[model samples]
Target chain A: MTAPNASPVQSRPLWGAGKTVVLLVGAAILWSYLGTGSNLLLPFQADGRHQVALFFSQLFPPNLSASLLTRALRGSLETLAVSIMGTLLAVLIGFPLGALSAYTVMGNRRFSEAEGSSAVARLWRRLIYDGSTLLLNFLRSVPELFWALIFIVAVGLGPFPGVLALGFHTGGVLGKLYSESLEALDSRPLEALQATGASTLKVFLFGMVPLALPQLLSYTLYRWEVNIRTAAVLGVVGAGGLGQDILVAMGLLHYQDLATFLIATLAIVIAVDFLSTFLRLRLIPS
Target chain B: MAPSIEIENLVKVFDGRVAALDSLSLQVEEGEKVALIGPSGAGKTTLFRLLNCILTPTRGTLRLQGCDVTRLSEKSLRELRARIGTIYQQHNLVPQLRVAHNVLAGKLGRLSTARALWNFWDPRPDGDVVRALTQVGIAGKYWERTAALSGGQQQRVAVARALVQNPDILLADEPVSSVDPALAQEIVSLLADLAQEGGKTLVVSLHSVELALAHFPRIVGLRGGKLYFDLPPDQITAELLSGLFTRCEAERGVPERVLRGAVSPVFPLDSPYDKA
Candidate 1:
C-alpha cells in the first residue's frame, strides 16, 4: 500500500468546456425566435433577372481588344494599389499585436508562472484582440459597395477611399493574425530574456516578433488580395476604380468592354496571388 | 555579518482557497548555500517565490539586506528583482535566439530600456557575453541557439545567464531535478561552486534528499508547511531522516551509495556532491 497521506487527487472532468457548448446551442435557439425563417431579405439576383440572355451573349464575345486590354490594365493598377496599401498597413500594425495577443509572452506559449498569474493580462489581451476583431467584423460586414458609397460621400469615390477602407478593416484582421502568431511562439527565449531582466516589451520584440513575422506578413498579404477585390467592387459607389468603369460600360450596354474589364481583373488578381505566395514562402527561414 | 534574506510568517493563497504557502519563516546568511527539500507541497516553491519578490506575501515580513520588501514601491521592487537571479528546473531559455543573447539578457535590468531595445537587433556586447559563457564551461558554443545544446548544457546556459546578473542572492527551484544522474550531479556541483567560489548566497529547492545532503552543508527539510529538520550535514542522523519517511518503510533506508552506514563523508569537503 502507498503512504497514508499519498491519496490520489479527486478526478473531475473539465466542466467549463462542456458548459460553453451547451450555452452556444441554447443561444442559437433563443436568437432564432426574433427572426423570420425566410432569407428573402438577401440581395441574391436569381438566374432569370437582368438581361440574362443578352448578358451571356455579351460575355461570349469576351472583349479581347488590344486597346481595351490597356484600359483594363489601368483598372488593374488601381486594384494592385489597393491590395499593396491595405496589406502594408495591416502588416505594420498587426505583427506586434499578434505577438502581444499570444498566450505566452513569447507568442502563443504557456509558461509555468505566466499561466498562473497572467489571468488578468490574458483577459486584457483577449479584450484588445476581440475589440479589434469586432471592428474588422463590422468593416467586412458592410459590403465593399457600402464602404465605397459612404466614402464617395466623404472623400469622392476613387481608388483612395477603397484603399482607406481596406487599410482600416484589414489592419484589424492582420493585427489578430499577427497576435496569434506571436502567441504561438517558443516561450523559452522570452524566459531567457526575462532571466536577464529584459522587460515584457523587449522580450516580445527580440524573441517573439522574429519568430511570428513570416506567417504574419503572409496573412496580411492574403488580406491585401481580398482588399484589391473589394476595391474593384467599391467603384460602384462612385469610388473610382474598375468597378466604376464596369458600371459605365454596363450602363452604355457595351458588353464587349465589360467583358474586357472582367477578364483583365481576373488576370491581375491571379498574378498578385502568385507573387505573394512566392514571396511569403521565400521570406520564411527553413 | 548581514543576512541576505529574512522571512517571517510568509503566507500566500491562490483563488483564496488553495494555500500555496502557509505561515512560513526562514533566514539566509550572506554567502551561505542552502538546499530546501520537501515532498511536493511543503510550501518550498511558494517560499522561494516570496523571497524572489515575484510574489508578495499576503501576511508576513520579508526583509532583504535590511530593506523591508513588504512595503517596497513598484520601482523599488523591480530594482530588487534585478538583484536576485533565478534559475528554473527546466531551462527557460528562448530557443530561437543565440546562446550569447540569452547570456546578455542577464544585464537587461541594469541597462536602460532604450539600450535593451537596441540589443534585440544587435545582441552582441563585447567581452561580457563571452566571459559569462566561459564561466559556465560553454565558451565555444556562444553562437549556437539555446535549444541546440543538451539538457545539461542548457542548464549551464541558465547558470551563465544568472552569473551575468552578478546577483546578490541566487534562487534555483528544483535545479537539477530534471537531468540524468551524471548531469544532475554536474548541475549540483556548478551551483555549489557558485555559492562557495563566487560567494553568492544561494537557495535551491529539491525533491531528492540524497542530492541535497550530498552537496549542501546545510539542509532545510520541510513537511506540511513546517520545518521537519534543519541541521548541518554533520549533525544529520538516520533518525532525523527517518522523520522524513516516517510512514514509508521501504524509503526509510539510508539511500547514500558511497558506503553503508556512512553519514557525512558521503559528502566531500573539496567537492561536496555524489559522483555517480
Candidate 2:
C-alpha cells in the first residue's frame, strides 16, 4: 500500500526528469574536462601565477597621452557608427522576413486554419514560411566574425565590411526574435481587425503594428547593444574599430596603449547600454 | 429586401468531434433587434462567430444579405464582413493604441492600406471619429491610451468602434457580462437605442434574462447547440426560464436557482473586467 502521507508528486521516482538532466550535465562536464586535458589548478601554480602577474602588471598605468587617447576615441566612434548602421540595415532586411516567417503575422484569415483553401494557396504559404525560416537559419548560423571575413574579401577591409557583416548576422537574429514576438502577440485584437473586413495590410498596420512595435523596438535596441561589442571585435579581422588598435598594441607589446583601448571599449559599451535603456523607457510603456 | 443574415442547417464541429453548433436554422430580418440567451456552453458564441463569417460552417449554408458566405472568394468575403460589426466580451481594443485610433479601426475596411497606416499616426480630426466618440460620451478621452481607461469606459470605446464601422448588422457577444448590473443595463439600452436610431440589425448575447427581456423585442434561447425556444419577451414564461437555467446549472453541478419574475442572475464579481 502507498504511504498515507504520499501525494502524487512525492510518489515520483528518485531519478526524476530534473535529477536525470542534472546527472547528464554533470557527466558531460566531466567528459569535456578529460577530453580537453584542461588544467583547473594552473593559475594557482607558482610559475603560472608569476606569468599571470607579469602580464597584469603591464596592464597598469594605461597610456593617457593625447595621441593615444585621440586614436582610441576615434576608434570608439567608428565602432559606434558601424553598430548603428548595421542595426539600421538589419531592421530593413529583417522586418519583412520576420513577418513572413510567422503564420499569424500574415493577413490571410483563411490561412490560419490547417484545412480548407486551395492546395496551391496552401503550398505557396508553406513555401514562403519554410523558405524564410531556412534563410534566417543560414544567416545566423555563420558568426559575425566569419561574415566579417567574407565581406572583407568582397568589399576590401574597413568599417564598411564590418557594417555589412553585422547587418547580415544581426538581421538573422533580429528576424527570428521579431517573428517570435509577432507570434506571441494577443491574437484577439488582430481577429477583431480582420472581422472588420480590413485588408491584410490594413490589419497589420492598425492591429499588429500597434501591438508589436514596442516589443520589436525592445528587441532591436537590445541587439544594437550586442552589435556594438561585435563591431569592435570585427576590427580583429581588419574590418575597422578599436579592436584593431587593441590588436596592434598587443602585437607590438605596447600594453599601455592596449589598456587605454580596453578602457575605451568598456566606456562605450556602458554608454550604449544606458542610452538603450533610456530610449526603451521613453518609447515603450511599462 | 433580403434578410440581414440567414442560416440553414448550420453545423460547426470543432476538431471533428465536439460540436459547437448543430443543425441550427435562423433568420434575422433587416433592422431586427434580437437577443440570444443561454447557459455558458450553449454555443451562443459559435452562432455569433458563424454570423460574423469568421468561423465557417462545417455542413450548411450561411448567407449575409443573400451572399453565400461559404462560396465567396476571400476578397469578396472580406467585403461582406465589412458590413458586419462585432463587439467582443473583452472589448478587444489594442491596449497600447490611442482611444481615437481604436475607434478609427472601424474604418479600416473602408480605407486603403496606405491611408489606414497614415490615419493610425495622424487621424485627421474627421468629424466622424470625434462624432462617434461623442455619441459614446468619451469624446474628451480621444487621445488617451486605451488601457488607461476603466472597464465601463472601455466598453464605451468598443461601442464607439462599432459605430465608426457604420455596419449594417451589429453582433455583440456578451458585451456587458463583466460589468455591474447598473452599467450593464445602461450599455444594453445604449446599444438598442443606437440600433434603432441607425435602423441596423443587432444580435446581442446576454447572460441576464432580465436585460434580454427588457431591451430586446425577441429572444432566442439555446441549450446544448440547439434552439430551445424562439419567442417574444411577453410570451416567455417563468417556468420556461427556470427549466432552462435549472437544467443548465444542474449539468454544470450547481444547485438550481429558480427564476422568479424579472430578477437577473447574480455573478461573483470580485473585480469587474478581471474575468476576461
Cα-based lDDT at residue A126, candidate 1:
70
Q: Candidate 1 — which residues are off by over 4 angstroms?
A: A1-54, A92-147, A176-197, A203-222, A238-241, A272-286, B123-125, B147-150, B245-276
Measured by DockQ, the strongest candidate is 2
Report the TM-score of candidate 2, chain B only. 0.89
Considering only N, C-alpha and C atoms within 3 Å, which residue pairs clash in candidate 2? none
Q: At residue B92, what lDDT does model 2 achieve?
A: 79
lDDT value for model 2: 0.83
lDDT of each: 0.67, 0.83
Task: Estimate how well candidate 2 is docked, as a DockQ score.
Answer: 0.39
B50: Cα error in model 1, Å: 2.2
lDDT tens readout by residue for model 1, B1-276: 659988887666554545555676788899999988765455665566566665556677888877887666435655776788888766367665678877777887788878866764574654877887887788999888676888778888888888888888999877776677787787788888877887889898877778888899899987655677778878888877777645443223423321111111111122212222
Q: Estimate each model's TM-score.
A: 0.74, 0.91
Q: Pairing residues by index, what is the TM-score of model 2?
A: 0.91
lDDT of 2 by residue, B45-73 (tens): 76776787777788988888998887877
Question: Candidate 2 chain B: worst 10 consecutive residues by lDDT?
Answer: B256-265
